[model samples]
Target chain A: MSIALYFFAGLSAAAALGVLLFRQVLYAALSLLACLLSLAGLYIVMQAEYIAVTQIIIYAGGILVIILFGIMITSRLAGKPMQVSTQYPVIGSLLALLIFCALVLSQPAVTSHTSDFSTNHWQRAGRWLMTEYALAFETTGVLLLICLIGAAVTAIYQRES
Target chain B: MSPVLLYLSFLLFALGVSVVLTKRNAIVVLLGIELILSAAILNAIHFNQQFPDRMDGQLFALFIIVIAVCEAVVGMSIIIRVYRYYQTAVPDQINELNER
Candidate 1:
């Protein structure tokens, strides 16, 4: 299980780098899919089963498709690789590395303890969402509705000159 | 286990920040934001593992995921509108946001 966790972590990191490195929008979108899937796998390894499933269904299935459609519709570089302009790669990388090192150095040494991975994550999550988090869940629904309407209006505004 | 997980999430978050900083394309910028959001989800779930019975972290992660989807939808629609109007999706070249 730990080995699987490490494997998915590496895969996700590599795919995330691909998302950063790809010069074309389509390629970057594809890399994002890979990253999301690997992250889902990592979630499963960490006993986050419901989150893993949600990650796959929502991120890989839904969001990725939306991004791909956006890429196809908005960009005129169809069938041709469009060069994405990236500035200050060296400085950006240096800053990121600094942040990474700081995070690593700040970590306290692990206290050895056996993790209890009993399988009620989904049940409890559902209960809390329905009970304690019911208000938040309803708010999310409202937000989603607003987003849907807003997106449609914005996309179809069709300003007349 | 926790230390390694924290490190991975931090690394991912940093990479996402770099992508946001360096990429000029609007879609790529959105992708960077998504990456950062996912890194945060990973952290939330990791913390949840510490107390498996309490579902607050996982529930919040789920909420974050939903919000992220909504964000991406709205952001992509806006990007489409920008592309239609300006005929390009590169942020640096879009002068509409700049003060004249």
Candidate 2:
């Protein structure tokens, strides 16, 4: 588990760096895919198989595809494969380094307790959703519908008079 | 709760912030936002591992994923609209609101 955790963690960090350094928008998107997938693997190592699966399905599967489509369409509109440039690259990288250092230095020592009994995460999550979080669940559905409608309206190309 | 995973998320967050700060492309900026959201989700998952009995962290992570999905969709749509109007993808170049 430790080995897998370190591997995924390293992969995710590397991919995130690629997202920052890559000049091609396509390459950056691909880096994001790698980062997200590795993070999902880390989730599995943490013994949260349900969240891992959800991460893979929803994030890697759904969101990544949508992003790729957007990239493709936008590039087509520009009549060239999309490329990227940077502004204040040095300052931005330095700021990020400072932020990371701050996070590491300011964190308090952590203590974790392992549970003796293993629970069925899927069943338990479903039960909680249907019972304690029923209202939130329904509200989420409504929110998604609203987002779909809002996005469609915003993106629709209407000739502005 | 796990320090390793927590550190990893922190690293992701910092890198994401840099991408947003430096990148000129709106799409890349959107990707940076995704990275930031991912870091937040990782934090929730790490906390879930810490307290296995209380599934609040897991539940919050799930809901956060939904919110991120919405954000990405809307964000991309807005970027597309902006590109159409400005004929460029860089956020810095969109200066219609700026006094000439």
Candidate 3:
């Protein structure tokens, strides 16, 4: 488990860097896919099976398709492949390095815990969502509905005008 | 809360920051934001494991995923709109909002 965790973590980190450094938008999108998949692996290693499945479904399936559509639409409209220009590369790298150092320095000490991987993690999570987090769950549903309508309206309105 | 996980989260977050700061393409910036959100989700799940009796972190991470999907949809729509109006998706080249 530890070995798999570290391997996924390293893969995720590398893919994230690829997203940052890749020149073409499509390349970055592919890199983002790799990063998200690796993150799902990390979630599994952390024993969060429900979260892992959700990550793969929403991020890799839903969000990535949306992003790819966005890329396709823009590239079609522009009649060329999408390539982003870099701005303040040196300064951005320096700032990122500085923040990373701060984060590393502030990490909490690891505490040992007895391994107890719950097989019914999704069941427990669903119960919590329906009970303790019921209000938030309902709110998220409303929020998603509103966002869906708003996005559709915005896209249509933009195309018209 | 292994040290390796902590370091990995930091590394991913840093890469997200650099992507957001340096990339001119709006879609790529959205990708960077996704990376940052993933890192945050990882931290939440890690701590929740430390207190396994309560699954608050897992639930929170689930809600976050929902919100992130919404965010991506809305953000991409707006970016497409901007690309249509400005004829460019590069943030530096879009100055209509700044134009008086």
Best by DockQ: 3
In candidate 2, the residue pairs with backbone N, CA or C atoms under 3 Å apart (3 or more residues apart, or in different chains) clash, namely none
Q: What is model 1's native contact fraction?
A: 0.75
- Per DockQ, what order, best first? 3, 2, 1
For candidate 2, write residues B2-50 as lDDT tens digits. 6888798899999999999999888899899999999998888787766
Best by lDDT: 2
Clashing pairs in 3: none
lDDT of 3 at A150: 98
- List the candidate 3 regions with Cα displacement exceeding 4 Å: A76-80, A112-114, A157-161, B97-100
Per-prediction fnat: 0.75, 0.73, 0.84
Per-model B-chain TM-score: 0.93, 0.90, 0.91
Scoring each candidate complex against the real one, what DockQ results? 0.71, 0.73, 0.78
Q: Please provide, for model 1 over B1-100, each residue's C-alpha lDDT reduced to its tens digit, 9 standing for 90 to 100.
A: 6777888889899999999888888889999999999989988887776665577888889999999999899999999998888898886778876899
Which segments of model 2 are wrong by more than 4 Å?
Answer: A76-80, A116-118, A159-161
For residues A58-126, what per-residue lDDT tens digits would candidate 2 score against the true structure? 989998898898888777456666889999989999999999999999976666665544667788888
lDDT of 3 by residue, B47-95 (tens): 7877768889888899889989998999999998887887777778777
Please write out the lDDT profile of model 3 over residues A37-78, one tens digit for every residue: 999999998888899999999999999999999899788546
Per-residue lDDT of A1-161 in model 1, one digit per residue for the tens? Answer: 78997899899999999998888888999999999999998887777788889999999999999998988887786677766889899998888889888888886654423347665766777888899999999999999999999999999966597
Distance from true position, residue A57, model 1, in Å?
Answer: 1.1
Least well predicted 10-residue stretch by lDDT in candidate 1 chain A: A108-117
The clash numbers for all candidates, in the given order, read 0, 0, 0
